[model samples]
Target chain A: MFLQQIINGLTVGGVYALIALGYTMVYGILELINFAHGEIYMIGAYLGIIFLGIFTTAGLTQYSLPLSLFLTVVLSVLFCSAYGFTVEKLAYKPLRNAPRLNPLISAIGVSIFLQNYVMLTQGATDKVFPHVLPVTTIEFSGITMTSLQIIIIVVSLLLMAGLHLFIMKTRTGKAMRAVAQDKVMASLLGIDIDRIISVTFIIGSGLAAVAGLMVAMYYGLVNYSIGYIAGIKAFTAAVLGGIGSVPGAMIGGFVLGLIESLGAGYLSSEYKDAYAFIVLILILMVKPTGLLGKSEGHKP
Target chain B: MLKLENIHTSYGHIEAVRGTNLEIRKGEIVSLIGSNGAGKSTTLMTISGILRPVKGKVIFEGREIQGLSPHKIVSMGVSQVPEGRRIFPKLTVRENLEMGAYLKGKGQRAKGKGSGVKGQEARGKGEDTSRGDSRIALAEQLDHIFNLFPVLKERQKQLGGTLSGGEQQMLAIGRALMSGPELLLLDEPSLGLAPIIVIKIFKTIRELNAGGLTILLVEQNAKAALRLAHRGYVIESGRVTREGIGKELLDDPAIKRAYLGE
Candidate 1:
């Protein structure tokens, strides 16, 4: 039972880690808590449903489930990337130089706008994601695993690894880091600051789109409001790991996932949501910088 | 190679550079000497397209580049080592140098038109192996910088923030050099360094100038700047108050009293 819970915890943690990456990366570059990022993830979920619905209606799902799923992911990622880019351009770009508080408020406004926009258009009710992925169980050493669980963990791992390599080995990634460190200096070195910020949004949103698809598949349901709870939980995960640190988000996400899952299973399933916050508060009290975060210190 | 004609730059309602005119000839080190808030950095910022002048033209190599973006200006071969040695602190020495060569890498990918690479591809770095030429060029530049400041080579793996102030300044200049700039704008390279280190930096600047690289230097150390410069301009209250050949400005009694600490 304990081992089975670990598997379940890992599956959920992988999704949280994916969503938390969007929050952490945006915050890393802009120093603003992109309150609307959760909305982007929520939008990703809706886009996945909408696209998968189209594929089903067109009879593509009858041809091959994998191909249909692939097309759906690709379309959702593209749309989510566009949404992320447009949000930065419309909502955040104009306020780049404004006082810190102004952008924070603007972000909140964007969050509300996106949530309402989805609710008004897609309706406030829970939307059913098309049932396409085959449900098969794999039992090993008294633990049962679903193919979907393996798929979720594999997809999340691939995306994170790809992101890590991109940030470490690519010129654009280095430029992003440079911009994060010092905007003016990065500009002087020929890095287009605005473009880098846009790229951040696109990447973050793309990852969220994949996570949205996985979650929809796992639970077989999604709602406009799902982004709020998931976003707050992922954000708590970000803070728990380290708000601006990429690795921190990954670690924080899994940690929160495990804590919540184990707490719900062993103690009380009624207070599953509270476990994340409880651990977050405890971690913050002990190591405010989060697990992988560097402590703020005086510059020489 | 660069000229700022009757430029006026401002921060909101308050103008910082009011009708400032300056010129730098090819292969000459022209130093702009002034006190703090006298528009020294503002003029450089304007030249680099970091600050768009409210009025007037910035002509570089006879092209009007006043309204260009900062990256556009950098691609055009004008790079600035900004004030305070603003090296990316968290980046390692090698990574910082790699960032300096960012435009060079972009320039290559942009040339392959049929590959659908936008001059600014925002998705991620492409898998194209077309970086061969730029990669070689980057290595040459890195070697040049390491040779110029051997200590940087030794500390190539260290994070930029861990470097001492003098070493950071050297890294800043090296990073700028990696951009392969024609006209380099350095703002207060001598700021917050020991005298010996300052002299060494000045020596490197003189060496670079000797190699035929044109430079526009802004300095509060008027005497050293004038001595190294081919010509000098003393800016005060947002305008060029005095202009002369290096020694001519160095020996002027008024310049001595106002800036030379008579």
Candidate 2:
């Protein structure tokens, strides 16, 4: 039973890690908590369903499932990235020079607006994802692992690895780091700050789109309100790890997933959601900078 | 090669650089000396395109460039070593230098335009180089900077924050140089350094000038700045109060009493 819980935790943890990356990366560059990022994830899931439905209508799904899924995933990611880019350009860019509080409030406003837009357009009812992934279960002793769980873990790991390589070895990645440390100094060195920030938003949103599609497939159902709980959970994971650290977010997601799974399994299923916050509080008391964060001095 | 005409800049309601006119001929070391809040740094910021002047024009290489962005100004071969030596603390010294050369990387291959530099192949020219050649050019640039300040080469792997103040200042200057700028604007390069280190930095400035780099140095150390500069401007209350030859300004009684601490 414990091993079974571990497998379930790993599946959920992978999804959380993917979502948490968006939060951590945006925070790293702008130092602003992108409250609207959750809405982007929700929209990704909806876009996936909408595209799948379109393919089904066109008789494409009947011909080749893999080709249909590929188209769905690509279109969903592109549209979500567009939303992310537009949000930053419209809501955040103008307030780049404003007081920190102003952008925070703007983010919150954007979040509400996106949530309502999705709800009104897609309707308040829950939408069912077309069950297309092969359903197979492998049993070892008393523990059983599903094929879907394996796919989620493998895809998430691959995306994370690609992101790591892009950041560590690419020129644009180094420019992003430079802008994060010091904006004015980066500009003096001929780095375009606006373009870098836009790139950050686009990448974060793309990652979130993948997570959204995976979660939709895992559960076979998604709603406009799903982003609220998932976003909060992923954000907790990001803060628990280190708000601005990428690796921290990945580790935090897995740890939080395990804690929630065990809490639901052993303690009380009624309080599974509460486990993440309890650990967050305990960790904050011990290390205010989060698990992997370093204290940074303000620029003079 | 650079001129500022009636530049009036302000922060909120308070004007900092009010009607300041300055000119630097090609291949000259021009120093602007002033007391605290006398607009020396503000003038540099205005020229670098970090701040937009409410009135006046900043002409660089015979082209009006007052309203261009900071990065655009940098790509046009003008760079600033800002006050406080804002080195990225988290990046390694080498990475910080790479950031300085941000323009000469990926985009240069596609654009084939470097900076507005002329007459120096090893200094600022970055055109007509292929991918493999550009990589070699980058390494050669690093070597040139290392040759200029041997200490930076030794600390290349260290984080910028780990370096001492003098070393940080050198890193800042070296980072700016990686862009291969024709016109370099320096702000308070000698601030909060030991006398020996200050002398070394000033000597390096002289070396750079002799090699054909135009320098606009802003300094509080009036005596050293004036002595090194071919011409000097003393600014007071956001205006040029005195302008003359370097030695002539050093000999002026009023200049000595007001700034040289005679």
Candidate 3:
């Protein structure tokens, strides 16, 4: 039973990490909390459902589950990346040099705008995500494993590993880190600051899109208003991990997911959401920089 | 290779570079010597396209480049090693140098054609063996940089912030050179260094100038700067007060008294 709960927590936490990465990366680069990040994920979920609906109406899902799923993920990722890029260009780029508070407020405004835009277009009601993924079961001894949970965990881990490798072993990745450290210096080295920032948004949003699709597959529903609370939860995860550290954000999400799951199971389901905020406050009080916070004391 | 004609750059209302004009001929080393607030660094900033001249024209290779972005200017073979040695502190020595050859790595940053947008294609650096020529050229530049600062090569794995001040300065200059710049703008290369290390840096600059690199050096260390350059300009209150050949300015009694502290 305990192991089953851990698997459940990890499945949910993996999704949280995906969404949290978008927030953490933007914050790492620009020091903006990117309140609109949650909306981007929300939009990703909508895009996923819309694509799935298209596949269903076209009678494609009946032919091949793998083909339908592939198309849905590809279309959703591409559209979400574009949306993330446009958002940065229109909403955030103009305020690059403005005082810190101005951009933070602008980010909040963007979040609200995206939320309402979706609510108006998609309607306020929860949209059903068809149970496309097969519900096969793998059992060992007394424990049973759902194929969907396995798929979610495996896919999220793969994406995270890919992101880590890209960041550590690529030229553009090095340039992005250089920009994050010193924008002026990066530009002086012939790095296009604007282009790098756009790429950062794209990568973050792409990850969020995958998370959105996974959640839709898992929960089988998505609403426009889903972004607000999830955004807050993912943000808490980012803050819990360390706002600017990539690995920190990943770790934070997993840890937060476990805590929330365990808390609900052991304590009270009513206060499950409260646990994230409580942990966030405790982390802020104990280690304000978050777990694995980028150490300023360490030279370079 | 570079000319600034009647340039005026400002910070909001207060002008930092007031009606300053400067020039650096091809393969010649020029120094702009001034005290703090004399606009030497500001002049370099304007030339590097970090700041646009509110008035007057900046021509590099006979093209107006005053309002172009810094990265654009760099690709035009104009690179600046800014004040305080602004090396990315969190990156490793090798990573820092790799960032230096950023334009060289892609060969499109200089042409303003490459972008970080299609970054999904930025696959692993392992496949970089495809661009054999550029890769070899980058290796040669790395050898050159390593030759210039053996300490950097020795501590290639060390974090940039962990390096001593003098080592950081060398890394800064080495990083700038990786771009294969035609006109290198150096701001305060000798700031806050041991006098002995300052001499070594100046000697390296002299050697670089001799090997056919045009340099516009900004310095508060007036004595060392004027000593290395072929020609020198003196600025005070954002205006060029005097311009002369290097030795002539060094020997000038007033300059000796005011700057060299003779």
List ranges where model 3 is wrong by over 4 Å: A295-300, B109-132
- Candidate 3: fraction of native contacts reproduced: 0.87
Q: Write the per-residue lDDT of candidate 2 for residues A176-222, one digit (tens) a residue.
A: 88888888889889998999999999999998999999888889898
Order of candidate numbers by lDDT, starting with the best:
2, 1, 3
- Residue-level lDDT of model 1, residues B105-151, one tens digit each, is 86532422212111112122232323457778578668768878999
Pick the DockQ winner: 2
lDDT of 1 by residue, A142-233 (tens): 99999999999888888889999999889989898898788888999989999999999999999998998889889999898888889989
lDDT of 3 by residue, B1-262 (tens): 7889999999678899889888889878899998888888788888888888899999998899999998889888887899999878889998999898898887664331111111111221222222346678678668768887899999999999899999999999999988777778899998999999999999988777665578899998888899888999999999999999999999999999989999
| Two-way lDDT contest, 2 vs 3, winner | 2
Candidate 2 lDDT over B150-189, as tens digits, reads 9999999999989999999999999998887888999999
DockQ values of all predictions = 0.76, 0.83, 0.74
Best by lDDT: 2
Question: Which parts of model 2 are misplaced by more than 4 Å?
Answer: B108-133
Off by over 4 Å in 1: A283-286, A295-300, B108-132
Summarize candidate 3's per-residue lDDT along A1-300 as a digit string, tens digits. Answer: 677778888988999999999998899889899999888898999999999889988999998988998999999999999999999999899999899898899889999999999999999999999877779999886677888899989998999999999998899898888988988889889899999999999999999999988888888999998888889999999999999889988998999999988888888879989999999889888988898886565322
TM-score of chain B of each: 0.90, 0.92, 0.90
Interface RMSD to the true structure, each candidate? 0.6, 0.6, 0.7
